[model samples]
Target: MDLTMSCSSLSLLFFISLHIHFLVPGSGKFLPFRECAPFVCGDKNISYPFRHNERPTHCGYPGYELGCDGHNPTLVMESLTYRVIHMNTNMQILEVARKDLSDDLCHGAHVNTTLNSSLFNYTSSDLNSILFYDCDSSPIFGSYPFSCPTSGDSYFAPVVDLEHLPQELCNFSVLVPISQSDEAPDRPPPSEDSDFGAPINHAARISEILNKGFEITWIANTAQCENCTESGGICGYDWKRQRFNCFCTDGAYSPTCNGTRVPGSFPSRNKKMGLKVGIGMAALGAGIVVTLILMRALIKQRSVHFDGEMKIEGLVSSRRYTYKDIKRMTNSFEEKLGQGGYGCVYKGKLGDSQLVAVKILKKLKGDAEEFFNEVASISRTSHVNVVSLLGFCFEGSKRALVYEFMPNGSLEKFIFNRSNTLEVDRQLSWDTLYQISLGIAHGLEYLHRGCNTRILHFDIKPHNILLDANYCPKISDFGLAKICSRQESIVSMLGARGTPGYIAPELFMRNIGGVSHKSDVYSYGMMVLEMVGRRKNIEVAVDRTSETYFPHWVHRRLELRQELGLHGITNEEDEAIAKKMIVIGLWCIQIDPRARPCMTQVVEMLKGSVDTLQFPPKPLLSSPSRSLAACPCESSSLQEGNDSSWGYSISIIRDRLSL
Candidate 1:
């Protein structure tokens, strides 16, 4: 025990001496920077030269400590706390503003802005001036003035150089930094009749000008990082010592790790000590990553679902739960929420009390293509409108996907009464329906353009639209989703996907146009039109047994400026919202895929005023029978009943035109 204590004490003494000497005895280096941890404070990410208190001593520059006050990140300099607006690592510049300052002059004004000269330098781009508060008399006309509670005594010096200012006219003053353009201007002196006691109309003017925040450039430059980079070491700041710290592959060090000779050129005096340091460094990420990978591989090997497959991709962003946990949380799959073509969703509670919908895939083989596609496609997205994939269970044949449990069920239940019951009890307001349309538009935009990879949700209908607690629409069910490179403009397809009513005209027949993002637009337009008309767009007529497409009927009403016959469209505002949706929806379901607007344009049109929207051409897709009869060539092989996927397809007109 004494020997053990002696060795430990000697190790501590060696560490202290190494820190003091700035070297590791004869090793001629410090230690690796594995201790540093980069993290996000509020919305800002902190790293080298700027760190939170939880970071290590070698993490950031001295005097650049940051702390979070609740959710907002703050930086204290010279006894004043400033809210960090943003920090750019490449520019080495930081934007911060006084936390106490307000954008409203009706409130109060008090600012003490100061920057340590050694650590920060006000770049030439930044504007500066002395702001004096409450002087006996206001300064000359050029000095920006504000009407405070007393009078127009509050004013700021205009010129950047402080010496030119008339010192005799000022009272309490502090040097403040502001943006170059649009500096504060003096408020007009109130006349005798003017109410001095009453706060001015533009009370927020002064605060607004000053609230833009100031930028500060760090003293460190490229030269400091140059030498370190050449020696295969990363240059960083040591906050405690107030100096540069170079983090190297083998170990961290001061000065430069380029010193001495090549690592293999010189023989180490003590190999045993070097081996111990090497082992410590390996455990950080490099060696640890492999160990983790091996353990996961072994776990996957024993799983019934993944036994045949070595690995799967695109599901790394979400968690993987065990079958026992899934069963316990779901109460043995008792509370079934809904069932679809792929699986059944059961309501479950996570350990953290978060309600989740666990979708258990039925009869799927270990390497089912649909299972991978669903998991891989949904996992790549993180948008409010897009359904979030919380976790999954792939224990052999029991494949289940976990998602945030939506309180309200699928939108189909509310929008159209699936049950043939004539119970018109609670109808969703026009406002709620309009908002849902916009939300669905934004979701499609995110999938097609916002994410890293382009995701095309082939199936986009009212049945697949799930509503949450607030009736906000979440686009769910990625059974027919396709992931492609953003660079790839068009995607190839094997067979037709999606419900017949909502499928794009082009997807039915490629001749109309190559399959692109507009396909989803066509689907969204069809679904939204049904929401506006309050009936299935493609209902089978009882008398003639012919299909009644909604976009055509809605377009006719819009063209003639007739009443839409919407259930909740009581007032002008509700009528306008309904009319706006019908117009945009018609534009989306244009027979020629090219005639339809993209999802982005769809969102814009929905947001735009009803007066601005223009009626689209009569939907030719609604009456394909007329076009076929008009065809001069009777032998043209445009068979109607050949394809069951598209019973009322636009391909008839598309193929007819090709003739």
Candidate 2:
């Protein structure tokens, strides 16, 4: 009887445990633990939908977690992004905060950690997916020296406009020092000596500053310097190099930070898992193998699989042949035109005169829906600046798009590629660039005004803007694009979209009245600046001594009447053309989106005299998160997979251009 009672009790306990684990409310059991809600790990204070510990563990995933160190707060997951105070929730959009490292006081004591793809990953368990390395500091215009009279602490703060700051720093975290009583135990000591000697009375100062409500970057020690430089890794310190560690570069790894390995050799648990999975999958495979065997035996009784429903109109016409035909057209896919956002574009000829650019999309699964959407969206619009789609093919699982061949190829070749140095020097003159700029402007205007629904060309860099034989610019790659009607007004974006540098600020804000045609105008302005400077916006301008965004650098040079020199005055015509372009570019990139002229207005400004245009204030290097608001273009170092060669070349080009 005792033994039977024990067994019954054990059974009851087991059942109760299962019920508690699986049935209890808010117990984080079978609830959506695999996909974390956006609010689960963000700032819990400040208000609305932004939440902490509101989601089940399953919903939050491995990377998403609300971290607390007793006093202050932090949110960490795959990518290390910080939020100010989380207050708003109904919109479900969290604000991303960046620290301004240019504050010498903060720079002296703290370090900046670059949480790149190699170091960590961004798991979009939350509604928003952020690219974390996009933080930037203001350029050192002229440094002002300061010494805390009480502690003999001195450093330099790069002189950026404080009046226009709050507008410039909408979505960022400024670290203000606090008094000893308010400081958190987890906070790192300001000095490298392992102890912050005295408590700072920063609350009063912080309150005073906050009362002003100007967005400013406060320096602090949230970064992990010791962890970063522990091994033989290259240390990426703060702007002042006070603290930081060396993590391994590409094709390298080790906690000790020594040695390098081929990409294939990188340690992965997936290999072991794959072996285990193969054994378990063997049983299921046998049934499939037998089925396949039976199907093969009855091959003679089977019908052809090619002729199915062709739901997409232009996807596969009767004239559309098979993959075999595409093979023969390109002579077994022999020549490659170039690679692009969708996939590799191959040069092919249907007949004697009809040359076509065949775009073979990369290996993307379940993209049929997206491909069909793109075709539908692009098919409705027609303009000289927009790439024309001849037709597309979707036979079986393979998909390919055909377009009219631009014999001169993409603008990237002329603007970014060095191989066409001679051709560009002779043919891509200032007049040619101006024409290209106009064509691109017209294309943007058409999307904004001409179309029944305004289309947002999310990606507007030179690479996406192709140049034809006459040097006319054609906007390509409608992927990552959105369409909105004027009546609808606002289109809520999920997280951050578009390329790193060219994305707009309001897009980062939750339901912040997005979908303004002004976003595209801002991107165009950056592109125009690129065309004028003949360099990417992320790269530093040549004339500037330190690293700064090209547009901001131009603003400063213009302020000093030094802007013209940035374009190396070869003659009166070149100087005149460059000056006009710079001033127009500056006006197009005004910090206030409302202040920025519409694309139609931009076209007028470019065509109008430089003297008529009011010179824009110098571009401020605010927090990276705030860049979308003021600068729009993200700096070069902030981009992922940014090759050293790419960064070096841009730096060199800007230097040469500055001459």
Candidate 3:
């Protein structure tokens, strides 16, 4: 009977131990194990969403837990070891390099990468997919001519073009993913001659690419975890509770860390067991508390950047890059294309061989507001005439915008010429000029009416027009832009915008009409006038003989039905284009803001015949008083129009006439 009672007690004790391990909730089991920083392995600094060995399961999300193997922080996801390089909370990116792969990466890269499908996915950045193929000498070998030689006869060749390999010599294949630097030169297409081999160094390039590491973005079922992570709290999903838990420095919190003191809200465990667990737990807890207090004090002494603005809420769709990434893309800003009041632009290349122009804004008053404004406005625009906003970087005070590179540069150089002897073939033809004019008008119309909101390009001038390789015009420079609802007829502004010659009269003083899209029309008109005369309208040095304002002279000549006296209007068609542009310009530059046609009207007028256009009255009389010839056009003024300006080359005119 004594042995039976002893055995029964032992069995009951064993059952209770099993129950406590799996079911009973304890202070240490549910709570974070009193740690401020999550990591100290190698050079890695671990933070939110990723928990280390010192942390409880509640401190980090599942599939993101990391273990330390000696000096390296190893992540065992999808049954592979990935060395943690860095983790960025703002970017929500985790970069990990393949630890199993050899350092040389070329001769033998048997290691492969796969993300935790439940929680993460590979970043959408362009990656080169390398497929390893085993092959023997056969007719099919020519398709995959380039080889990764292994044995004396057999080789591993990377075949990109071919889809299938015949059973005669083919063994098997495996695919590997590698992240590459965006600045790598584009590989040229393979030649028809296979034996010549590929130009790009596939082995060295790909190995370097793997060493750079890969990015995986976490995806939780709900934004609860995202909010918790953003609030500087560790986010972890409770497998047993089937809900997200935000763990703060104090203790495990609900929804978020509200700064309230710790409380015993957890399910109660057996009280008899508390003393046994409490004595040892109390000793460990006291040591952890002291360490945490010292760490908190040290961390508080460090300085923090004013980078909070970079994490603008609701700006997630656009890719956010680090300052280091920006430097790499721009090649340390080595090739500067141009510099303006807003920023400096540099030529750059993306990993996929696409050329780009990166604009780094200068630090100035209202820099933060302007940075966000430019991003917000440009990101909403998607048109052929509008420059594309590819990506952006906002780390601390350094901010930048990446755009598609326009080889031809701004239209200022093409339009503004100092010399009269420049050749004609080198210049743009009247036909091309008309099409570009029409394209600009179409883009303007889209911004005004087509977009969900009206975008008023406050500054529209020759300098802002950008031309592509095909001479197609695209509007750029949105530093002075404004957005208003379609219903709001007139937009509000504190002061006048645009360059001296291009700004509308009403913007300076609301005498003509309230500021509206019509203001953009006025600027466009001045630019079109410059395009026709091929010289500055007010006081350009193209010809010294004429002191009169240029547009007034063109108006008088048109009123008299006289010859335009343009150098490039050799043929009937050339003359017709010149007349069309002149008529459009005269209408756009009218002093009365109401008198100027909307962008929609301008587009139609450019498409219509020159004969249908009515001569516009002289606009100078309605402007602020200025010294000029009493008449709109005099003999001297007409002669000045006849002077060979920078463009309007005679050969180009004659060629058009001959055609």
Candidate 4:
């Protein structure tokens, strides 16, 4: 039986080799090249390396495929579609324009053009042009003002004049690539004599430049393709093998068509030695396939068992404690620390006499998936500025979280005058306040960028920031936090999060932008403003006759070049620190989320000198009349006077107040 099985296998291998060498046409010689011929889309000629979707997969290089939308050819790269304008195969360059921006400039969503760096690179002949949208004020110097009939105010400027343009005044700006010709001098600046004709001429000029498109040199295996074509063979790619192949009448060869057979291609053989070699090769391939299958099964089985054990251990790790243990650690709830919407907090001590703060969570109706997930996320964080989670207790409805104790408690007590008299008597110095702000910014920066999983502390205010013995600030209270992958730019929320006074405008109004890490920056800005003002941002006057928005008042004072008049400014250094904090806070609270700096930028700004800081534009929500409590409920009333900014502010205020 063993001899018969061996004979059967050898006979099968010989039959396959005979079939390949005789039966299938070009099977051992070449691939069908008729389907890979050059084609035409619109007026452009599409050839080798760039194939239409109708062509076979082997006809084009990977990621260089195109699709036809009616008569025009479109290429989708990195999610943005572009209309092909011209292709220079000799120079390996392509000229294309953004399909969305080709017909109407302001019709699409605000997004900058981006290219895949590995596949294409911008040519030096292309210059960057900035398009500023929803600008509150016209540029004072080097920008050409324009208006979109449907989208209101906008501005345009060349890259050379970026410093002169009022970018801070704009809600958002997009960087677009445009062709720069030597004859035109790169969109000549508007003349001093004709203000009216300048805008019209500039708008037309911008349209022409964008339509002309920009050039990008494509990165491909051009040298290999050229060698293959020079050898009188058709150049193509092997989709299955994921490499270049040259197709000749005799066979398909790699690198070049030099009458060489690729692996697996069988030729005619007449000797016993050749038959034995073919049989051995076939048996070896079969053995390798079988070995791979067995190894894959073993690895998968071990992985499942290991993952199951890890999960079981992770569920009942050292960090988890029983409800009975919590009672003994907290001394039967004897010493109360604080209480909030989540639950009450109590001072506790471990068996080693180490201090801790235990937060007893309220009873939730559903399973504890979200609870355990949040605990796991917090456990992974090890930053000094972030409060550490020591242990947790989740037995039935009784749940609690243990954290490392902060001797100084929350920051609100010291910042708010009415909270603690002792804390007010020993007021924090300006330097201390600045350090706290910088520390909090560092904490946020770590959460946003340094961690494996990005943690968005939706609630970022004075009340959520805790100070240690050395007065170092640590971000606390993850009740409303959202954990997402670091690659995620925007997170989806069912509804608005964060406190009313410190919430970002985009949380309640979708028109502002998506909810992202920028939202946390806004909250941080509001808190810093409160720390500088030493009062609530929106407060009624002592006489109760008028309401004042502190941010607006601070902006007016700065614009007038008057003293900030803040307390604890005994020297020029103190004055400079206060001014720097004010300027940074203003920048963080811009109406459009895109205008706000990231937490990393905020950290850099805090470390830099006051002279390096630029004064931010007037925040749209800074008006006293637009206070969350004062805004009218009717949408029509909010939209009156063609004031879109006011409308957005009113909408945000209404939603936040209702929440």
lDDT of 4: 0.70
Q: Mark the 10 consecutive residues where model 3 has the least summed lDDT.
A: 632-641
Writing each residue's lDDT as its tens digit, candidate 3 over 1-659 gives: 46445444543443334223322344434334244245667776665567785666655666667888766677877676777666666666677777655254434444445555447766544232333445455323322223455632222232221222344554543344444333444433446223465322345544554556767666654457667656666666564345666656444566777643223333334445565454435444544544454347533443233333532556654667777877888789889999988779999887787899998988644435567666776777888998888888876677888888999998777666665334565577789889889989988998898888888888899888989999888888777778779887776443356787788866643333467888899899999888877777766433523335778788778878888887677799998999899988987877656556788778878988787776665665243222321211112111011111222122321121121
Q: Candidate 3: lDDT of 628?
A: 24
Off by over 4 Å in 4: 1-318, 363-370, 417-423, 540-547, 622-659
Instruction: Report the lDDT tens digits of candidate 2 across residue range 1-659.
Output: 46445444544443333222322133322211222223322324421111244443322223324554342334442243343343223333332332232122232223222332211322121111111111232222221222333332222221122212322312222222111112222322356211244433332332322222111121223233234344534322211112222224331232224544322222322234344344434533443544454356433333222222333555432245577777777777789988755678888888766888887876653434446555655776889988887776666666677777888887756665443233535446776777788888889888877888878777788788877677778888776667778454445333355676676654542112244666777677777887776667774224343344677667667777763554345676767677777776766655446445677776776677667766664433222222333222221111111111111122221121111
lDDT of 4 by residue, 1-659 (tens): 46446545654554454324322343333333455667888887776688888777778887788988767788888688888888888888888888876777766447777776546876645656667777786643345566777665776654323323456788778767776542332323335313535444246655666777878888876778778778877777876456787766555667677757656544443335455456556765655554465357554555444433343255443388889999999999989999987778999999999999998888542344335545766776878999988898866466788998998999987787563233456588899999999999999999988988888988899999999999999998776777789888876542356787788866644434568888999999999999888777865334311236777789879878998898779999889888999988987887767667888888888998788766776676432222222111111111111112332233232222111
Ranking by lDDT: 4, 1, 3, 2
Mind sharing the TM-score for model 2? 0.49
217-298 per-residue lDDT for model 1 (tens digits): 7775545555765676755675323467666645555556765422212123244555545543543333344435445754
* TM-scores vs. true structure, each candidate: 0.49, 0.49, 0.49, 0.48
lDDT of residue 650 for candidate 3: 27
- In model 1, what lDDT does residue 392 have? 81
lDDT of the structure predicted as candidate 1: 0.65
lDDT of 3: 0.63
Off by over 4 Å in 3: 1-312, 419-425, 540-547, 621-659
Cα misplacement distance, residue 567 of candidate 3 (Å): 3.0
Candidate 4 colliding pairs, count: 2
